[model samples]
Target: MMLWITIKVALRSLWANRMRSILAMLGIIIGVGAVIFVLSLVAAAKADMMGRITAMGTNLLVVSPGQRGTGGVMSGTQQNLTADDAEALLAKIPQIRDLAPVVRGNVQAKRLAKNSRTSLMGTTVTYFPIRSFEVEKGRLFNDADCDAMSRVAVIGATTATNLFGTEEPCNQVIKLNSINFRVIGVLKSKGDQGWFNPDDQVLVPYTVAMKQIVGVDHLNEIDIRANNEADLDTIMDRATKLLRKRHHLQEDQDNDFSIRNQAEMLKTADSMNQVLALLAGGIASISLLVGGIGIMNIMLVTVTERTREIGVRKAIGAKNGDILRQFLIEAVVMSGSGGAIGVLSGFVLAAILSRVTSLQASVSLFSVALGLGFSMGVGVFFGFYPASRAARLDPIEALRYE
Candidate 1:
């Protein structure tokens, strides 16, 4: 019953100066809102990135040429990966289910009157299976096409839309670098993958790409599908050793290539997202700290304004603990209200972001809980000193004040 009375008094005090209370809560409101908004956006972006990376394939490994060092100074990537290297790895490593040596270039693709600049990849038929890509229309080019150096092309969904619009792109001839190639397939949309948009590229046979388009004898990269994830490390080690032997590199020499697996890439991506989220959250949290200080400052002023009221209460047999509880409850009420408002505002902001942008902002319960808890904690931490000061006031002195 005494606690209830103290709460009632706190509410009354806060209600008496509604504007001041609101002003005191403004910092917390903005702080909590900013934290939620930043976290939600970051979570959404991370999910989107992970989803895109996962879509690339399971149990997959990518091999790319490593940077070469010239006189102890690292230079640009070495063009060391070749179709022969890919073949050697496949022949030597039983863990590899499928592999494709790739060469790519950015070129203007023209089909009749329509044209679009897009990445053109030259890979084998196994590229489709290795990357888990499905052909939406017609068919993917086969190994026979790669071996025969056929001028056949497979367009991605975005590429199809950009060049052909509503018209069907399959069977149409698209010219890449002034060389005509018949479109045999259209790939299903895989959406954006952050740095790369798989849907915006075209695929052709590696032989044709090497000889006619990119004009490079060396491969840019190799996409390999491991039979199982458990065998990935063994496969990588074996492939690395085989490649080293094929390149005639000594045991002490560094590898001229790099091997990256899907799991490692996903882990790295997750770590990066976590760091970004923490950085954003840390920056936003400064407002919360400022808000806490504001609460402390306001509570101090409130104590001064109500000095005689405190005296009157103490003179009427109210204990120091009761006075402390009253002021503390007042601070908590103010901050709690601000936290509720901030949460609503954060949700609205998240919804607006989702609607206005491509990002799919997601609000987790953890974030909501964290915001509310932090706000209440701030109230308690900052409210304590002022409440204690009010409780410790000399009743006679306070009552004698003019």
Candidate 2:
């Protein structure tokens, strides 16, 4: 009953100075809202990134011909990997489920008046299943196509749009670097994947791309899939040993090839995403501190203005602890109210941003809880000194004050 009376008193005092209370809350409102807005967008971006990484395959290991070397001087990848190396690895290692020898270059693809510049990827049929690509129209090329060095291609969704517009791309012949290639399939849209876009390219048999187009005799990379995800590490080790022996490297020679696992990509993405979220949250938290200081200053002024009231209550048998409790409760009420309002505003602002921009933003229960808890914490920390000072005042001196 006494606690309820104290709460009622706090509310009445706040209502009496409504304008001052709102001004005091402005800083906290901005702080909490910013925390919500920035964190939600960060969360969304992280989800999108993880999805892209997963799409590349968590069971994958890519073998490349170069490792950037001492000073990272790379005119291009070393011309070390070849189709024979890929074939030897596949035959020797039963752990290998699928493999594709890949080479890539940029080319201008033209059809009539429409011209689109895109990266051209050259690999076997296994590249589709390994990379989780689906054929939306027509079919992916087969072993015969690679053997015959067929000038057949698969186009990504973005590339499909660029070259064919609304018309179907299947069975259409487009010119790549002035060389005619038939588009046998159009891949389902995978959207943009930031650093590497799967939906902005053309794919043809490595044989065709090497013999006639880019005129390269060596493989740029080999994308390998293990028979089981558990076999990834073992297969990587075995493949390394086999490649070293094939190239006749002695014990002193460094590896001319490098292997990359999907797990490393996932770990890197997670750490970078965490760092970004923390940075954004730290910047927004500054406003909460500023608002806390504002609350402390205003509470100090309130204690001074209510000096006579404190003296009257003390004279009427109020204890020092009682006096402290009343002032503290009043400050908490103000902050807690502001916190609730701020959370609502954050939701509204986040929704607006999601609608108006390409940014994907989402609000989570954790962010709301964090903001509210932080605001209440600010109230208690800053409201303490003023409440203690008011409690310590001598009743007689407070009563005599004009």
For model 1, which pairs clash? none
Per-model TM-score versus the true fold:
0.86, 0.81
Residue 159 shift from truth in candidate 2, angstroms: 2.0
Clashing pairs in 2: none
The reply for model 2, stretches above 4 Å from the true place, is: 1-8, 11-20, 37-58, 71-79, 210-220, 247-256, 300-325, 345-365, 385-402
Per-residue error (Å), model 2, residue 197: 3.3
Residue-level error in angstroms, candidate 2, position 53 = 4.4
lDDT of 1 by residue, 1-402 (tens): 976776687777778888988789888999888888888988998888778778777788999998888667998889888889999889889999999999989989998888899998999999898887999999999989988999999999999999999998889999998999999999988877777899999899999999999889999999999888898899989988888888889978888898999878889888988998888678657888888888999999988988999999999998899889888887887787778778888999999999997889988999899989989888999999999999999999889766
- Candidate 2 per-residue lDDT, tens place, 1-402, comes to 878998898888888998998888877888888888778877877778877778777789999997545655666557889999999999999999989999998999999899998998999999999989999999999999999999999999999999999998999999999999999999998877666789999999999999888899899889999888899999999999999999888998888899889877778887887898888788768888888888888899999999999999999989999989888887787777677778888888779978986567788999999988988888888899999999999999889877
